[model samples]
Target: MGSSRQCFQRFLEQKNIVTNLLGKLEENTGVYYLPTGSIAFLAFCLIFGYGASLLCNLIGFIYPAYASIKAIESPNKDDDTIWLTYWVVYSIFGLAEFFSDIFLFWFPFYYAGKCAFLLWCMLPVACNGSQILYHCPIHPIFLRQQASMDSLVTDLSGQALDTAASLTREATKAGMTHLQKNK
Candidate 1:
């Protein structure tokens, strides 16, 4: 039991490390994106939950579970308990989707569509949180990428210009030498 607990702790640490990397990457990129786990949770909920919710007549409950997992597993708080929670939430997504499908008219399309849309809307609000609390951390990374790309283009243009100038100089020198010889 203790070993199991230790193993769980390791899992939590791994999840947090990933979350931290994701947060850094998000900050580096301009577009605010969800962490991989949240994205996974959302996908599982939508893909799995849609069907489960319908089959089990539990769409309403499952939808909330999916949303809650994403909300609760923020970048700052990463641990084994939360990681386990994510898996539990994902399991719920599967069951919920399965149940939802059985009951709902649509098997996958409309039901999944609703959940996806709901998640899509949440991202902007997530990004808008104050920097001190929940700012879109990936914005800086994006800016840096843009700056780097721009600089790379500028360098390419400079090189092209140099090549053209060098060609022109060589052609002019050759022409002048030929004329002098002819004269």
Candidate 2:
């Protein structure tokens, strides 16, 4: 905890991040975007995303949207490998849930596996739920990339870190006299 806080303080002092653009809204307005209300859960809800992930799985039940992926041939295959991979991973996750339902029948073995799978499937959504709230106009299904909390923090905080790094480095170096001595 101390180290993490120290790092954050370093982040602040070094200004490796600029503004807290976390809540700042971009000016783009379009159908692809979700409102801010949904993203805020990112600041708090890791469990909620599991429910969202379950919903994500439901999206599979839909006749797979024949999304015309860019740089890929059209009508190449309605059921592309990418979609197949998604289905496979999610199915394993769903199977975990299914097994869990019958877990009571098997006690520790089924329950343990079920719990593990349930967590595996749901944790990403709950932790990274913020990404769901922000729809880039280009992502295939908005929040469909199976992003996790680390990825979300990177997406959310990476920009700030970049901005802060530049600003902080320049600020710290502004008073450097070694270069002046050489001159």
TM-score of each: 0.23, 0.26
Local accuracy by lDDT, each model: 0.53, 0.43
Candidate number achieving the greatest TM-score relative to the actual structure:
2
Identify the runs in model 2 with alpha carbons over 4 angstroms from their true place: 1-34, 41-73, 101-183
Backbone-clash count (model 1): 33
lDDT of 1: 0.53
Q: What is candidate 1's CA lDDT for residue 157? A: 100
Which ten contiguous residues of candidate 2 have the minimum total lDDT? Answer: 15-24
Predicted candidate 2 versus true structure: per-residue lDDT over 1-183, tens digit per residue: 999567545543442112123213333433223333443453223233434434434334432332214214556663354444434555654575677655543343333333334334322233322222222322455356547756987887989999999998887787576677778
